[model samples]
Target: MITGSDFYHVMTAMVPLYVAMFLAYGSVKWWKIFTPDQCSGINRFVALFAVPLLSFHFISTNDPYAMNFHFIAADTLQKIIILVALAFWSNLTRRGSLDWTITLFSLSTLPNTLVMGIPLLKGMYGDASGTLMVQIVVLQCIIWYTLMLFMFEYRGAKLLISENRGGDMVMNNGHEGGGAGEKAAAAADGKAKIMPPTSVMTRLILIMVWRKLIRNPNTYSSLIGLIWSLVSFRWHVTMPAIIAKSISILSDAGLGMAMFSLGLFMALQPRIIACGKSTAAFAMGVRFFVGPAVMAAASIVVGLRGTLLHIAIVQAALPQGIVPFVFAKEYNVHPDILSTGVIFGMLIALPFTLVYYILLGL
Candidate 1:
């Protein structure tokens, strides 16, 4: 069990990160050091360099065998559950359309493993926990992201099919100007030719998904890191010191810059409550409650105990990721859910984790 002193150390260790975020919020909201749009550059700096390198470092340095399958399974299963639930809810409620479902599914499924997971788990558990967290991040980058890309391609393919059908219908309508039997023949032809068959659409979507999966930065970085780890396992191969140090410099800047940018985003984002209070509440509840609950139960089933158990639980319950928010924004899927889910999720991350920590007997 975690002692009172251990808990105190954990809480205190978290203080600096929170303080940085608060200062960022104050800088933008009060002083206007930079607009939220301007902070996009900082986010780019973190994503293109910092986070990838951070992931690369832990992944490459750790024993490839250090990563385990049960943890990945539990985590992935939780994400799949969220996706299915959101899809059902989107159609059922009609409050959040299918577009909103993708964003909310992203928010609930992918936790902020890069920025928040690294520091918090390290503080609560130990140095080893950071490595474990990165392993989880590797899983998130590879599996969860590819699934998201599939969702986007699915939506796009549906739209294309719908448009083709509509165009065919218009053609059928114009054919009515001809002889009566001609119109009937035209309608029959339109119905036959308009929508691409399901198999055809499925093939198109799969090809797009494959192209995107290959091109994703996270995919490359994670695969490379895993390869490096596996290679090093047999023969002790290492990169040149100069190059490793250069990557380290960029990786070092990731966490602080990420926290500051998060704060900057909060300040830049307009504070109007556009999304329903209930939607926001449901997102938070799924993220903070259901996620960890599922992970915790899975951890037990997988026979993870003590620190391993706590780390998995905490990682599962970490705040929503900036990466998923970026995806939502870029795709124009559900900006409201991405924006609100992230900001509000950050607001409660600490208290929510603390509650989980106590209940877990950590």
Candidate 2:
């Protein structure tokens, strides 16, 4: 039987591997193993193809019938509540707003289940936990992704609308252009020409959101795989074994490469550390510590057991997924903060996440 301490060791073992791999990538980059653009291309390939394929593959393998729906429901609800509470708490810090609160909370609460959680669970709990991990990932895909995109897009819209309104007010007067003497006279009157309807701004926002979301072919490929899975579909075409081999390399090697790319990006930016500290701390605290605590407490209160506890542990302990960082990058919302949060969450989650599961004795 795997003891609680053994579980801790599993987590500890994995972190060093991840850290070592990331270091290797860093070393290679420092040595000019790849140009900056090359490194970026690798990161993009991982994010767009490898990661999503892994998600689809892991999720598609499990029999949906094996999932303990009762346990899944209970654990999922607990996770969401804890997440929302953390969002509220972070808002209290005043470092982030309700919008920022939502983004941080969502990102911190949802982990990279395909990359991290499934493997960790399988290692700790064997095949029994794999199916549960799959179900948890499924829930993440449906609920977490929806919430993430909606909140991010909404926040972007809010900012854009406010700026546009202010600009319109300025341009409405003579601020756009005028003769020097007339402009000075008009400025005294504080009057300007009424600007025409640039009011289709909302449509532009929608287009921007859709364009970004669909720009990555990999995201849609995952969607395709998901549909295939749901419809009980399989392709028997004997493609070269090279395809699976390539995917394997992409999924395993790609993660560290991705992380290193993120780190280098952070290293390039000034004020990354200063801007991200508060948000990073907040996200790490909730994700590795407080979030799990909330789930554990809720589990005990509701008398959850076995597979339920295992599922909860997996879900609670997941580090933030790359998708959140992707959005942060797209929206130009403090990449340093986002990168810091990812690094911090992954690092701290190593030991504490194991402890969370061990304490549960699941």
Candidate 3:
């Protein structure tokens, strides 16, 4: 069991991180040092450079084969279950758009597995405890992130194509912008019904989504990490020392940069909260309670034992991911709702995780 000193030690470690967030808030709200655009740029830097390098360094340095497939399967299954349930809920209420659905789903499914997970796990179970969390990060970056990106882009393409088709129909319907004589002539032509270019639209939408996915830096990072892991395992080729050091320097700053950038985002966010009270509460509940509970159950079924199981469950209770919220803002999908949800979720999950560790007697 953890002594009183251990309890204080864990809580103290969290203080600095939370303080960094408030520092960003103060920088924006009081000092006016950073404009909203500059905050967004900081977030971009973290996602494109810092976070990717962090992922690459962790993944490339580890043995991919040592990963437990059962744990991976359990994690994926939990996410899929949540996604399907949310899809049904959205359909039933008619209140869920694709934008909010993906955001809410991600908020429910993806945890704060990077900045928070690494230090928190290390504190509780020693440095080696974070290995499992790194695998989770890799899976999230590649598999989960890719699926969501494709869906959002693909759905957006369909909507744009549909809107364009509607405009074409209006044009062909003799709504002449020219003089009355042109309008009369156009109407008198008795134009045949123009069928929608359905097949062409399908093909075009696919292409558009493909292009977006390929362009995503996170996609490349995950792929490179995965390939590096495989190659390193099979051929015993380590990254050159110079290259590793370069990545290490940037990646080591990722956690601090991410926290400060989130504060900047919070200050610059819109005045109104788009997420409803009930929705925000539901997200927090799932994040702090339901998600961990489900993951715990899955881990048990798959016989995940000891520190591995503990880390998996605790990681589930981490707040929503910063990378996902960044993506939401970038896509103009559901930033307003996501912003509210993430803020509240983080506040609740952080303290709750502390208590959970004590109960576990770690």
**Local accuracy of candidate 2 as per-residue lDDT tens digits, 1-362:** 45667666576546654765466456544555666677567667666766666665665555554577765766666767756676677666766474556655655466766556766776676666767767777776666665566667767656744553433433333232232223222332356322223444344445545665677554565565556555553443332568656656666654455556555544344433444566667667766666566666677667787756655755677776666677677666655556666655665656665666666663
lDDT of 1 by residue, 1-362 (tens): 76888777777668877887889899889998877667778767766767777777767787767566766666666666667778788878849576767776776668888778877877787888887777777777777777788888788767755665533432343333233223222445445544434554566567778877776666777888889888987688888899888878977776777788788878887782346788888778878877787777777877777767777888888888887877777777777777787888888888888777777772
lDDT of 3 at 19: 84
Q: Which stretches of candidate 3 lie over 4 Å from their true place?
A: 88-100, 161-202, 270-276
Let me know the TM-score candidate 3 reaches against the reference structure.
0.82
> In model 2, which regions exceed 4 Å deviation?
1-20, 82-96, 166-208, 233-280, 297-303
- By descending TM-score, how would the candidates be arranged? 1, 3, 2
Better of 1 and 3 by lDDT: 1
TM-scores for candidates 1 onward, in order? 0.83, 0.72, 0.82
* lDDT of candidate 3 over 220-260, digit per residue (tens): 77789889899989988878889888888988887777777
Q: Measured by C-alpha RMSD in angstroms, how accurate is candidate 1?
A: 6.2
Highest TM-score, which number? 1
**Which sequence of candidate numbers ranks them by lDDT, best first?**
1, 3, 2
TM-score of 1: 0.83
> What does each candidate score in C-alpha RMSD?
6.2, 7.0, 6.2
- In model 3, what are the clashing residue pairs, if there are any? none
